[model samples]
Target chain A: MRTLKFLLRKEFRQIFRDKSILAMIFIMPTVQLIIMPLAANYEVKNIQLAVVDRDHSSYSQQLIAKIGASGYFRIVADPRSFRDALRLVEGNRADLVMEIPAGFERNLVREGAQNLALSVDAINGTKAGLGAAYLTRIIGDFNTDVRLEWVEPGRFNPMATIEVTSLNWFNPRAEYRFFMVPAILVLLLTLVGGFLSALNIVREKEIGTIEQINVSPIRKWQFILGKMIPFWVLGLIVFTIGLTIARVVYGIIPAGSLLTLYVFAAVYLVALLGFGLLISTFSDTQIQAMFVAFFFIMIFILMSGLFTSIDSMPVWARTIAYLTPVTHFIEVMRMIVLKGSGLADVSRQLLYEGLFAVVLNGWAILNYRKTT
Target chain B: MPLWAKTGKTMGAVTVTNLTKTYEKGSVTALDDVSFRVEAGELFGLIGPDGAGKSTLFRILTTLLTADRGTAGVDGFDVVKDYRKIRNTVGYMPGRFSLYQDLTVEENLNFFATLFGTTIRENYHLVKDIYEQIEPFKDRRAGKLSGGMKQKLALCCALIHKPTVLFLDEPTTGVDVVSRREFWTMLNRLKEQGITILVSTPYMDEAVLCERIALIQTGRILSIDTPDAIVRGYPDRLFAARTDDLPRALADLRANPSVRSTYAFGEYLHLAFRQNDTENVSGLSRYLAEKGHSGIEIKPVTPTIEDRFIDLMTRETTPS
Candidate 1:
């Protein structure tokens, strides 16, 4: 224990001695946390729409007004013909074009039906799909309004209208930042724990200091723990700073106990740092270690169910997702912070993280050879 | 209890028999059928040029490497079996300076001390003679220290644990002459403290400082004896000659039927004669003068370790 303590002290001294690394450790994560949520936002807004009105009628005008007032669409073009409206989309002035056929209002009043041709720019498939869906919803509401106005409201009811009032329980506003901030917090912690410890021993190898340790009587476990524990503690500190940013800037407070969150974070960091040490043992250079850590962290972040739901993934990918520590930690973070889950709610995730900590740390200790 | 348990006796500090190591699928042999021993409290040197397997031998004795075909031990513990015990009992300074460059000198020293399960105060006396020289700049990072200072810091760190056996692989390869002399002086002091020291150097001048030296080349031990004894073992008469033109003198001497071999050695040329040759000084002077050489002088010089080393290497590579 005493040996480990001194080793930890040396590691901390080295880490704190470099001014640039100190800045990178604390400042870079804060900036990334603040900017990534804003840039990676999924809520699509201000869709550009072009309208071609051939029927100079009030009904057609009213439909255009309604689309504009829905707050989702912007009327960027008012073309006199369908050809011009199509040109608007081709020129990138608008994302969608709506063409009302000739006498469209007269036909709708006389026959109670009219055809409206709509074309959307599908170059950016996601924006086009979502904009089209929103337009369809607005048109459906207009259609029902026209029907209710033409007939007596009490007798014209389409067989017992059912109202669907959707309520998002955890995030009522469906704010993307709430979900993203927590996941980014997990990524920040993983980056610190994984890359720093991965490069620790390899740096020793590069500088030739590893021979001094290898010749000593220090146990392999003691040496590994000594090399890793300082980074583990730094990871936790970074985690706390991330949480503070989440609470102070994003107003995200955990529903469960902070103690439970810290407990899981502590165990998760041990597993992460252990995995880093394992990479260090295998790599002889810092560049090799960095590349290997990057490969694993990339996979962990992508398949971690952070941005996409793990259940929606294929069975093979889902199985692989379960093996990544990021997946479980992100799940726990969202559950406790957004759902206000308790110990019982996160017991399964906690168990998995605990097991990972034991297995990975054990593997690192066993793989670390004092002799070649 | 054994002497190692009570007095930290390093009797038979290192022993290797038929030790062989091959790399790249048994194609390049590093150590081939090598055997040697060092008595307790003796300063031993493994002398060889680069790629002579000196570092390999040190690594094996330090338990950092394994031998493929032979057995070795350090301080009565088998290198392969009782590696942990050997690690605790030996201090190794590799060919490269292995101290943490980013760490402060004091921090590096303290770290090694703590790793050996002791503190700076506990082993201060052991490394004090060396560490005190660099103590004023103890707060400076090792990377910023001068070459000589770095050498001292590495030596101090290696000696911090007070092990029974000390292994230094080329401790003074790149060091200046004054620092190299100071380093050997320090080693002589450590030897008086009853620690068996095994040091390897490519510099032949350093070999004379070791009580028993093993001259090695091409993964083979050419000769293992005291420096004086190895010098005495050179059978052929050695001669040093100077001429107005060195290269011409060397070339013409090599062409002579009486001269066995000749090499240009800085200010003069050294010549070796075959044991059965009857060439004398006057005959050699006459030959060099006839070859358009002037200011010729020839004399018998005492053979140094380097001369013996060159002699042994030539004999080994002479396709016998």
Candidate 2:
């Protein structure tokens, strides 16, 4: 324990003495939290839309007006004939073309039905798909209104109607920022724990100081813990700053106790830093350790249920997702922060992280040899 | 010294038996069937140039590396099995300056002391003489210190633990002359403290400072003895020859029928005469004059360790 104290003192001294690393630890995370949420939004809006209307009838005009009023599109072209409308679509002046047949009004009164054609440009598939869906919904609503106006007092109804209303819980409007902010917090902590400890011993090796330590009487565990504890404390400090940014910049205060969130964070850092040290033990240089840490951390973030729902993944992917600590931490963070969940709600995740802490750190300590 | 001479007493400070190591699947032999021992409290030097396997031998004895073939023990602890005890009982200063460069001198010293479960204050007497020289610059980063000060700081850290045996590999390789002299003086002081010192060096002059030395070359020990004894082992009588033109004189001496071998030492040429020829001064003077060399002078001279080393190396490479 005495040996550990001195080692920790040296580590903290070196870390703080390097001005660039200090800035990276404290300032960079705050900037990334504020900007990443604003830039990473996946919700698409303000689509550039064009429409071609062939018939000048009141119904056709009303349909065009309804499409314009839905707040998702802009009409850039209106042609007089079906051939002209098709030309508008071909020339990139229009995204959708609506053509009412020549006998449209006569057929609706006499035969009680009419045919309309819609042509859409599907080059940008996602934009075209969303635009087309919106236009279809508007036309369906217009048809329903017409049918309702046609019904007389003795006319038969279409059938019993069932309407579905969705209420998005937790994030009521489903703002992508709320989902993104918490996950970005996870990434920030990961960068702190992974890179710092990964480069610690290998840096000593490169600079030739590891030879002195290797010849000393220090226990392998003492050396490993000395490198880990300072970074562990630094990781928590960075995490606290990230949470402050989440609360102040994004107004995302946690619903559950901060105590529970920190408890999980502390254990998760041990597992992560342990993995980093394991890489350091196997690598002979700092560059090798950094690249290895990057490979694993990238996989951890991608497979963690942050950007995509784990349940939506295939069986093999889900199995791999369960192996990463980031996945479990993200699950716990959302539960406690968004849902106001209590201890019982996150106990399973706590157990998993605790086990990971033991296994990874244990393996690291065992693999670290005093002799080679 | 015979291995059995010290066996009945406390085990020698360090011992090795037929130790052999190779790199790249036995393609490069670093140490080939090597064995030696250093008596307790003796100042032993492993004298050789760079790549002479000095660093490799030191590493194996310090318990940082495992030998592939034989066994080595330090302070009565097996290097492989009892490494932890050996680590505590022995101090090693590697060939490279291995102290933390970014750390202050005081901090680096204190750190090594703390690692051995002691404080600098407790072991101040052991390193006081050396540490005091650089103590005024205690706050300076080790990387910024001069080459001499760096060597002193490294020695201070190595002695902080007061180990039974100290291993210093080429501690003066790049140090200045004044610092090298001061370093040897400090080693002598350490010897008075009853610490066994195993030091390696490439400088031939440094060999005489040690109580005994093993002259190493190409991973083999050519001779092990006192410096005077090794110098006395030079096989043939030698003469120092000089002329106004040295290169021509050297070539002329090698061509002479009376000369057996010749080598150029710093300002003069060292020559050996054939056993059958008499080496009168006029016979050599007349020969040089006939060869177009002027102001020629030749005289008998004593051999040094370097001359003996060159002799052994030439004889080893050349078949009889």
Candidate 3:
């Protein structure tokens, strides 16, 4: 306990000593949390499109009006030829191009067939796909309108339609920011938690202070535990502050118990701190520790499913994903904040995270040597 | 039993038998079957130069490393088996200034004290002398302190726990002359307080301050004795000689058959006669004067610790 007290004091002093580190811990998170969620929107809106309306009939004009009224696309230009529409897309002036055949309305009226072509930029594949889906939905609605006008008011429909009623569980609004904010919070915590502890030990090694500790009457466990506790507490404090910003600024209140989130976060902090300790053990310099921590953090954040869905990942990748502590915490944070999942819903994730904490910390302690 | 109680004997004495440590595992032997003992309260010095294995030996003795083949006891506790006990009994200051740079001097001292399951107030006297020197900068970050101040802080931290034995490995290497003198003075005061000190240095002049010293080189002990005794045991008659042209004079003496070994001392050439017979010096002086060496002066002088060290090393490798 005395060792823990000393370590905590030392860690706090170190954190407070470097002004840039203080800024990274307190100020950067707030800025990133607030701006990232608002900017990183997956739901695309106001897609700019050019239309080549070769069929100048009232029916074709009406179809264009229907596309414009859908509010998903802005008809930025009405080009006279298909080539002009293509140029609009190639020149980056438009995201999509819609081409109407010369006799589209006449073919629809006489032969019950018409064609509309949409060319979308597939470089941002997901955005392109969403744009195509929105355009298709508008066209389908127009077809329904034409069919309704031709048939009697109470006529029986002969086609079978499958309706997909998607009930977005946690975040009913499907706010991507709400999902990203919590994950970013976790990333910040891990980065600081692991990096700071790693720096603590590596700094000692660099400055030659480690030799003083090594020759002292202190036990190996005391020394390591003393070094770890302060950072762990600081990480928890940062975690709390992040959650507060989510609640107060973004109005994102977790559906699950905040107590449960804190508990899980506490365990996760241990795992990260242990990881840092492990890095420090192998590293002889602060630069080496920073680089090693950076490498692991990149892998952890990528595999954590912060920006992507883990469910969509392949089975082997999913298995590897489970090995990362961040993965479990990100899932738990999302479930609690978006889905309003109770402890019972996230108990399995908590268990895995806790186990990771124990195993990693145990391994760190085992590998840490009193003598070099 | 309390953890400290269980390892109480570690503070009693340290003993090593046939201790050997090889760096690069057979490529270089840092400590080759080196064995020595430091009785309680004795200030033992390991005198050697760079690559002489002083730091390596200090590390092994302090329980910061394991020996390849050897048994070492610190205060009646085995170095490996009773490492915890030994740890509690010894304070080590490595050659480098290694305290937490981000932390203030007081914080460094407090942290070290707390780690040892003690408090600074409980053992203030042990570190009080050195601490007083650095007290003015107690609030200053260790990184911002001068090299000498950093050295003092390191010593204070090492002494904060009041261990029975202190192992300082080249503690004064980079320190200024004044700081070096001040540090040695502190060590003397600590010694008077009955704390055994094991200090290593490459400086031959510092050997005089040690109770006894082991002159080591290339992982071998050339000689071990009191500084005076080591100097007294130097066998050959030694002389310091200089002329108008010192370099030419040195060359002339080296060329003379009567001169066995000659090396440049501070202001003169420290030369040894090939034949220790008192008759050889006159012939060598007459020969130098005849060889166009003017203003030549030669006087027999008592050998210093460094002089004896060179002579011992030379004799060790000579075919005879």
Candidate 4:
């Protein structure tokens, strides 16, 4: 125990002595937290539209006006010919083109139905998909207006309809920042905890100080813990800074208990830092340790369900997602931050993090040999 | 207890029995059937050039590495089975400066002191003479220290715990002359405290400082003896000569039938004979003059450890 105390003191002095570490601890969280949420947003808007109106009828003009008034699409081209409108789409200046056939009002009044052609650029899938959906809904509303005018206008339309009145359960306003803030918080902790600790021991190995340490009577566990505890505390500090940025900048407050969040975070840091230690033990240089950590963290982030739904991944990927600790932390973070979950609600995730902590640390300590 | 408890080899502060190690799947033999022993409280030296397996031997005995097919012990503890016990009782200063460069001198010393589970005040007397030279700049970071001061600080850290045996690998390889002298003086003081010291160096000049030195080359011990004894064991009478053209004189001497071995040592060319015949001495001056040499001066000279080592190595590599 006395050896461990000395080790901690030495570790902390080294950590603070490095100016880069302090900058990373404070600056990284604030910058990534504020920027990632705004940049990674999924809300698609301001889609460019090109129109080809052969009829030039009042109904065609009215439909175009309604689409523009919706503020979702911008009319970038109003070509007289359909070929010119397609040219605009091909040139990438237009995202979608809407075409109205000749005699469209007459056909609609005489035949009680008309055909309208819509073409969307499928290159950017999300932007194209959302743009097409909005346009279709607006045209349907226009069709309803034409029918209601022929029947008894403004008198309930003589047709039965059901109103949706959708209620987004967790995020009532469906704010993207609320959903992203918690996920980003978990990611920051993983980076600072994983990369810093991974590089720490490997630095000693490169500089030959590890041989000095190894030749002494210091126990293996004492050395490993000495490398761990300081980084673990720094990880928590990074987490707190991320949370503060979330609350102050994004106006996001965790709906769950702070105590539960901290408990899970503390355990997760142990697991993550142990994993970093495991990599350092296998590597002889800082570059090798970094590449190994980077490769895993990339996989962890992409499969953590932070940006995509885990339910949508293939069976093999989903299994990996469940195996990684990041997925569980992200899930529990969302559950607590948005759903007001308690300890009982997140008990299973806490157990998984605890299990990871033991297995990873156990392997690190076992792999660390005083004699080789 | 029997001195050789397990291996039954010669027992001392450190012992190795036919130790062998190979790297890259037995392709490069670092230490091959090599063995040596250092008596208790004796200042021993393993003198060789770089790549002569000096550092490898240090590591194996310190328990930082293991050998393929031999047994080694330090302070009666087996390096392999009782590694932890051995680690507690020995101090090692690797060839490289291994202390924390980011830390101040005092902090680095205190940290190592704490690692051995002892306070500085406990082992102050052991490291005082060496530590005092570096203590004036204790607040300075280790990375910023001069080469000599850096070495002194490394020595203090290694000795902070007061181990029974100390291993230093080339402690004066890169130091200035004045500091190198001071370092040897400090080691002399350390030996007086009854701590067995085993030091390795590439410089043959440093061998004379050791009570006994094992002259090693290519993972083999060429000879092991006291400096004076090894010098006295030279097989042939040696002579030194200085000519206006030294390299030409060396070539001429090497080609002569009477000159057994010749090489340039400093400003003079040293020669050894195939037989203990002083009659050739006067004949050699006339022979060199006939080979277009001028201002030639020749005289009989005593051989240093270096001369004996070079002759031994040349004989070892050449077929007898």
RMSD of each: 4.2, 4.9, 5.0, 3.1
Each candidate's clash count: 0, 0, 11, 0
lDDT of 3 by residue, A234-257 (tens): 788788889889999989888778
Tens-digit lDDT track of model 2 for A1-37: 8789889999999998888779989998998999998
Say which candidate scores most in TM-score.
4
Misplaced by over 4 Å in model 4 are: A52-57, A79-92, A99-117, A150-165, B1-11, B239-264, B267-300
Ranking by DockQ: 4, 1, 2, 3
lDDT of 4 by residue, A1-372 (tens): 999999999999998999999999989899999999999778878899999888899998899999999999999988988899889988999999999999998898888889999999999999999999999999999998898777654666545789788889989999999999999999999998789998999999999999999999888888988999999999999999998899999888999988999999999999999899999889999999999999999999999999999999999999999888999999999999999999999999999999999998899888888766
Worst 10 residues of 1 chain B by lDDT: B1-10
Position A29, candidate 4: lDDT: 91
After superposition, which runs of candidate 3 have C-alpha atoms over 4 Å from their true positions? A45-111, A142-160, B1-14, B235-302, B311-320
lDDT of 2 at B307: 87
Task: Please list the residue runs of candidate 1 whose C-alpha ends up more than 4 Å from where it truly belongs after superposition.
Answer: A46-125, A142-163, B1-10, B239-264, B267-303
lDDT of 4 by residue, B1-320 (tens): 23444546444899887889888999998897887778989999999999999999999999999999888888877899999998899999999998899999999999999999998999999999998889999999999999999999999999999999999999998999999989999999999999999999999888999999999988888888999999988888788999999988988998899888899899998888777776888888899899999999998899999999999999998956
| Higher-scoring candidate on TM-score, 2 or 4 | 4
Give the winner by DockQ.
4
Which candidate would rank higher by lDDT, 1 or 2? 1
Give per-residue CA lDDT, model 3, range B149-268, as digits (tens).
Answer: 988998888888888889898989988999999999999999999999999999998999999899998887888788889989998889988888888988888888778899899989
Residue B95 lDDT (model 3): 88
lDDT per residue, candidate 2, B86-179, as tens digits? Answer: 8898988987888988889999999999999988999899999999999999999999999999999999999999899999999998999999
Question: Which whole-number lDDT from 0 to 100 does residue B231 have in model 3?
Answer: 89
B1-320 per-residue lDDT for model 1 (tens digits): 22323343245778776799887888998999988778889999999999999999898888888889887878888899999999888989898988888888998888888888888898788898999899999999999998889999988888888989999999998999999999999999999999999999999889999999999898999999999999999878889999988888877988887887778776988988755455577888898887888999999988889989988898899944
Where is the poorest 10-residue window by lDDT in model 1 chain A?
A152-161
